[model samples]
Target: MEATISLTSQDVTKQDPTALFSPKNPIPMETIFLSNIDQAVVFPVETVFFFQVPPTKASSTLNICEVVKRAVAEVLLVPYYFMAGRLNFNHGSNRLELVCNNAGVMFVGATSRLALKDLGNLSLPNASFHRFIHRPGLYKSLDETPLFTIQVTRFKCGGFALGFMTNHAILDGKSASEMFHNLASICRGEGLKTHVFPNERTSLRARNPPQIKFPHNEYVKIPKIPSLATSFTTQNQTSPSPLIFSNKYDHKLFHFTPSMLKSLKDKAITKTSSFEAIVAHLWRARTKVVFGNTDELSTVLFAVDIRKKISPPLLAGFVGNGVVTAFATAKVRDLVERPFCFCVEKVREGGERVTSEYVRSVVDWLEVYKGIPSTCNGNNFYVSAWWKLPFNELDLGFGRLVHGGPIVSGNDEFVLLLEGNGGGINVWLGLEREKMKRFMNHVFDI
Candidate 1:
């Protein structure tokens, strides 16, 4: 059943959406060049953090939005000022760049009469949560789009939800987590004293005379058509569009306890980590249901942080995209019919191939191809593991964090592995209504 929610204008008020920077530490006006990895992800990634406060006298009158807005302006934005800028496509260079003219981000404040308990399981993905986020205009141009947008919605019980959106072109998961940690520290009045915020994009600059040493099979060149320039809208895009707004799929979560995880590792021929074991099982099961018994090829894609994998490693505090796609492929018959260990080995081998040389080759290949976008086929599956991220530790000085994860599963083919509350793994995914029923039944068959 769909959740029915109503938010009257009287219940929510708007503040200055452009005060995303600190006056003392003004953002410099300049264009920041981005790397191929940064350009690959053109869409904004949406996530939410839930906090619940005790029924105390101080909690009733506290304005959570104002507090957070102050923290963001006076502290968070100082080191991460690029987030307050807009994305601009440089036609001459044929690459996307950030124009840092101090264009501030959008911040919203809202209130609801409903209590946090009224919402079903907070751990699960819910469409109703979309109301808490400030969705950017998809049709807007890059120059007009804000790099970040946040919304704070207070519940009747003094609890609140912080919905955040950031352009993936600006930073990856690691950098985003670093920003959150800094924000949390600043909110507690400790103030930020971390490493100098690294914004050196040219450190990963493409090799001169672009050397395509390795075949980057993960990417394919786009057919030369009249280039109408890059648009913010994801319409008519390739598989796995940036943002998903369809209601044709069902979002569900699966839990894997430590004991269950150990069982999977023990079953494998060689010892494997939790990620390898869990993803291998999910890939095999999904391939079986999605492709049935067939000889067609199925591929699994995930990201591997390349911060230290590259030569002359990126700055320790590097805050740009520093991840490369690692993928494994197998025929449907082999992936489904074989034992779980086979898929596990394939996943492990794919990740192992991302050495320093391989990372360099990926960068050079993108340069040779003029930063062409990668395409995903129907048989491809994407998985992201966020169980180890420091989101649970983010204390904003208002309430304690109760739940945190992706706002919604982007697509049926995409799966997110997050840590459960009770020391287990929570696998959040979306699938067609009928297919989801089959997936849920088969998820634990191993």
Candidate 2:
């Protein structure tokens, strides 16, 4: 049976701040780096959430909408920056800036006669999943796209799912989760309360002379004598890189129970985080499946949150993009032939290497060479994990959520890890189809 969705209504909602930006009451328009990194690349973040809890007895179709609408209004009033800002080029510094203009957000509602189970097990959502989520189509420029959009789809089972699409440059996963928690609290009549949005933007700003102290090879290909690509590239630091189309890869999720994770860790060379061991295991298995009996160079680029890595760690509530991507490159033969512990050790060493100096260096590198295609290579595999993030407490009027994770992947060989049922974990992989059969066998064999 096919899943069918019918649109009930859709509209653009503007932010009504308690006070407007004026000469006397001006909100600082700090052009935070990486906040507008999308200026260089267009990889919009699309995430989805499905709630099994049927609406409360008092929750009618209109009541649900009003609940969301009011919650958003209250939450935006405090963190209204989400509603008023858009990315733009800062001519003075030659970079993208988070400028304030109440461009607003998009809200869409949909209804489906099919229940969640009738659609079968949701591994990776089918292509038609877009019909259930907010999709910001290609815009003339990044400035035209809204920072956030929401789509709430209700099923015949009386339950509902939420799809959220946000510009990566504006808010990272942490910020988005914080905002969601606020929304959920309001729906349950717990008057909206939120953490203080950190004012640490300037803390990570580039120096006036753009000094490069430590090594930041992960961010940019720092030339001996840096020559900003003033002529060949857009004068802006985060200018859009020339588009390079990607090959289609069938995406699917593989889940591992908590006990299985402990077993993998026990086999590690020298104890490592569950995340690191999983990455090493997947890297080895995927390498074997993708290029069997070959000696090609393969690289794994994984992202690390730097909130606690810096000398003076960022506050817990700090938001925006504070993640840095680091790499572990190895020959395919070595990756497949080496003991599993060898790879796990490599991950540990790589983590230790991204010190405060390394993070600072990356910031400098990006400031100098804005949109240089140096962060990732054609042979790289991307990895990110959100297993530790809290989403279970997002109790709007609905009970516990059944599922929540990204619906779209920006990388070709990307692997995303998220929390699964019980204490298990979900592994989402994007791979070429025929090879996926081999991947499944190897993944299960372990």
Considering every candidate listed, which one attains the maximal lDDT? Answer: 1
1-446: candidate 2 lDDT, tens digit per residue: 22433223241222222222222212454344443223333345677777775446314543465557556654553564544456676667666666666555666666666666654555444445555666555434667666677777767666677777776566667767887787777778886656577734556666666667755444444243134221112323332232212344666777898898888898894768888888888888887887754678666767777888876787777766666667676788887777888888877767777888777766666677764333344335667687776765677766457777666433354577877767888887766678877888788555
Worst 10 residues of 1 by lDDT: 227-236
Global lDDT for candidate 1? 0.75
Query: With candidate 2 superimposed using the best TM-score fit, by how many Å does residue 279's alpha carbon deviate from the native?
Result: 0.2
What are the per-model numbers of colliding residue pairs?
Answer: 0, 0
Error of 1 at 98 (Å): 0.9
Off by over 4 Å in 2: 1-42, 54-61, 122-127, 208-217, 220-247, 291-296, 371-376, 409-411
